[model samples]
Target: MRRTTAAIAIIAISVPTVPLTYGRSQVGGARVKQYQEHLRTVLPEADHFVSKGGEYPHFRGYIRGTAGEVDKLVGLAYLNSDVGHAITGYASEIVVMVGLRPVGTITAVTVVTHNEPYGYRSIDLARFKNQFPNRR
Candidate 1:
């Protein structure tokens, strides 16, 4: 007999309705680096990120080529807000970053920030985040 487990990549927490303020002109170079660091946690194979615009805004993660140029597409990273989801947690909206493979499987999910009081304890646990990886 075989047992199967289903994992939903979506997770909710709490966050304020504010646009991201991470840009070279707004928050300085260090802030951008910090944001990228967060992104790397979900898409470790990505070495370069390019912002893509559309109904579902996302970042195209790419890997560097042999000659030190970014040429291969690795995965896509996007925030829940980009998909226009009104999903909220205990307090408010939960901002989460999700990395997905081209074949529609989830690579990983990372909670960028949250405003949950009690929920934080559970959401912050590694096991909670670990369950999201390799799921569809």
Candidate 2:
């Protein structure tokens, strides 16, 4: 009876630990690398990004030189979920990363993630995505 109780306790402790470790690994894994690529796609001019803290968080885009970042601000990039929490697609939320010039012109908009059933035929198309860039 004591052995059985000890085994049960060990299983309970180990089960939760596995998921926590897995979750942390994922944060630093392929998905994060892909998202960084997405950010670069939208804000190609920015060689470096600095997170700006606010009620709605955003990245201040900058061009890094041999010394460091240039004083001139290039653009801004942010996720839609940070500003538009209530927006959702058919299956789930459609997260987008938007880049803008200093003058507020949209540089580009890229869909970071979406789960809509027919999204590939529409939202994933270059024609649809192309419309956002250069827009106010």
Candidate 3:
């Protein structure tokens, strides 16, 4: 009985300790839909937009679309978890890959204010603006 009680207590204690991770779905299906809607509004001429599973952290999806930009491609992604936590308020390095090559990069990543954690200070947008231009 003691062992069972101790086990339950241990599990309860560890539950909250486990970090929360957000994926494309974690952002909420409605939010993802909203983002897609916003993207469509911003890039109305896009040929098409597709979403796929991401490879790291809390990344939920990899969005690809074609607009009138030089590269004609843009990506939208979401991160949730410790990896997300680290980059929550800052823009981290993002490499945009083209057919077997990296084409452009986004620098000074900043978290969208709506996604910011409660009680934490706001991050400077200028601090996380684009830093990398086109790189081979």
Best by TM-score: 1
What ordering of candidates by lDDT runs from best to worst? Answer: 2, 1, 3
Flag clash pairs in model 3: 24-60, 90-109, 91-109, 91-110, 108-128
In model 2, what is the error at residue 28, expressed in angstroms? 13
Q: lDDT for every model?
A: 0.69, 0.70, 0.38
User: What lDDT tens digits, residue by residue, belong to model 1 across residues 51-129?
Assistant: 7665666777888788867489889887776676745877777778889988888898888777777744445547767
TM-score of 2: 0.67
Q: Candidate 2: where is the Cα deviation over 4 Å?
A: 1-34, 65-69, 119-124
Model 1 has an lDDT value of 0.69
Q: Which one wins by TM-score: 2 or 3?
A: 2
- Candidate 2 lDDT for residue 73: 78
TM-score of 1: 0.68
> What ranking of all candidate models by TM-score puts the best one first?
1, 2, 3
Candidate 1, RMSD to the unseen true structure: 16.2
